[model samples]
Target: MHYSLPLALALGLLLVACQSAPSDTSTSAEAMADATPGAAYQLVWSDEFDGEHLDTTKWNYNVGGHGWGNNELQFYTDARPENARLAGGTLRITAIHEPWEGKEFTSARLTTKGKADWTYGRFEIRAKLPSGVGTWPAIWLLYTDKEYGNQGWPDNGEIDIMEEVGYDPDVIHSTIHDKAFNHSIGTQVGDTLRIPTARSAFHVYRTDWTPDSIISYIDDQRYFAFGNTGEGWEEWPFDHDHHLLLNVAVGGNWGGQQGVDTTAFPTAMEVDYVRVYQQK
Candidate 1:
């Protein structure tokens, strides 16, 4: 996505509006197949976070302070429970304000880069997001192929199934990045919605990807779609395997636009479960 650049940030700019009570808007892992046109969807891989610790077999930690091309403030550390933990049947990625290892804030970025990368499939994550300004929580996918070298992003492709900033607590964002359509060039394919329960209740953030199109959804409600342009790989590089990334960033570009709420430290993005289904 080259999210490092602020091509167009709708959630970062919008203030919360139309307040309402939180309600359930979840879509089951098995429900997409009936409406999905393809081989019947089948369960493949998942992590329910039911254990006391993160399962190393399915995930890896991206530990660093290099800004990740996004100028993010958090120092992503490895195996630190305060930054990432699994308990009570959920995986919690907590972002807090504190001085540790020479960084002002600490958080965790979990990825399935080598462990479970996939091509076309339906991916779902049930999560309750963090609140307050400056928090940028995202559930996104990055291309995993090594053929293009360092300049592969945007060309390789990126799928942002869900992203919510702290200040705009009511909106959720979904977008797809490619060479033909990207934020840097102002041609990115994306959409956003305001959901009152976004930060307060658990909802399913999803992507239904096939050979023909890529669709994003929340609580079973479809909101964004990017159809295969039939042009070439420059516009549709999603035919290759991509890995998942989950993290909450602080004060950088879009997330830090309106200023950070110092009092919101230790806020968390709690993920109830993550599941993937592939067309069989």
Candidate 2:
């Protein structure tokens, strides 16, 4: 959810070992409904990637190459099977080093903007990351509607459930940005956890959001939490609706800080599933 590069970073230093969490591999709604018994949160929305094609009713394509306010190098394509597709019960978002629309790379960005937006819930995603310098893969959330301030970006809010730069392999990041706490001013609230097998194996990345706070977890261990300070909206605009987004970029300001490795062409972030749960 880093739309623009920051002059400095206040990254969290609480790193921890990656632990394993029990995973529910079920793709049926009936199964998920019964999986979390006596739990505070209940399954409400999900996409298991169990279909042979991307479910249009559940996902929408975001197409563009305008750097997405981050000086990114990939041109996001719409409905392009080469960039985004479903296969073997998983969703593959590929970033290819190819010429397209005057850009050197092409990829796909899928969002659940109008389809699914939530105020407070537990957002969980299970996926294996892509590596090699120049790649930037992310599973994050953005404000669904511009209702707070004039500038939709920092004025609204953003939640980065998981983000990893190829150059810094295995380091997963979770961040939240608002008018008062944004990277532009080097006050963003965020954290990073090193998961050794993040690029080789599937791991669960999650964010539990409530009216009072927003917390992030890896596998099932908590690493970061930002509590609501009775402060103004500039500090916590997450009280409104936000939607999910998934994509892999070729390179850009942060992702291309060390420069892109052309040899790493055709890399992909493979997602097993995305599930959302709200308190019952």
Candidate 3:
């Protein structure tokens, strides 16, 4: 059959083979990638959070008690089900009041750094945010460079698809940090979206990143945009591959601007799914 896109042809061939051979995750996920509504982008990687456990093949837990560069109160733990777990089709990253490793709170930080890195794609995540004074939940992306943290942040590029500070309910943030423009110098570019039901309901947070521009949205409605300046990586470090990061920090600089409620512990960021699509 004649197809308008090259991906359509590649997918058609993969599906036909799937029906004959024993089905595996690689092909099955591919077949379902473009099934979602959008501009016909092909799914390169995804996690539906459909298991009794957090899918290790797609994620790694960033565990530590150090401040995480944010002076966050929570000590990020690894594999502690109460901190991070998948159940009933959702991945919950919880922050509890109990102390751990010198920190008064415990939480989880998950990443797909080495396992799933995409050059440029339409990255999306459906989640229910946690809200309470001092809570900070974020879904973001970072460059896959070896000099990322060592050389300093922003220089490596950071894309915040969605971030919410607990005290300000319903006000969502989308930001991009680079050497030329960043929060440290007060020149970062970002915006807020007020969605009344954000804390109690699920929403799709998306970012369409390409070679030239990065546009973000909340349930398909655009709110923030950053385009290439063609000057250098200092201003547009997004011209390379990046990985995903999902975490809920507690009492950090931004989240603690109003101080920790203390009663706000035991909150969490519930992720229903994460999908990445690219135009092949």
Cα lDDT computed for each candidate against the true fold = 0.79, 0.81, 0.77
Q: How close is candidate 1 to the true structure, as a TM-score?
A: 0.88
Instruction: List candidate 3 stretches off by more than 4 Å.
Output: 1-39, 147-150
TM-score of 2: 0.88
lDDT of 1 by residue, 1-280 (tens): 2463332453332211111101110122224434574458888999899979999899999999877787778899899999999879999999989987887899999999999999988899999999879899999999998444245877888999998777778788888777766656545557787889988899999999887678888998888766675667876788889999999998787787778897999899999999999988
Task: Put down candidate 3 lDDT per residue, 91-133, tens digits, no spaces.
Answer: 9999999968888999999999899988888999999999789
Q: How displaced is residue 126 in candidate 2, in Å?
A: 0.2
lDDT measured at residue 262 in model 3 versus the true structure, 0 to 100: 79
Pick the TM-score winner: 2
Q: Residue 199's C-alpha lDDT in candidate 2?
A: 90
Greater lDDT among 1 and 3 belongs to: 1
- List model 2 lDDT by residue over 110-170, tens digit each: 9999999999899999999987898999999999978788659888899999998887889
Ranked by TM-score, top first: 2, 1, 3
- Return the candidate ranking by lDDT, descending: 2, 1, 3
Collision count for each candidate, in order: 1, 0, 0
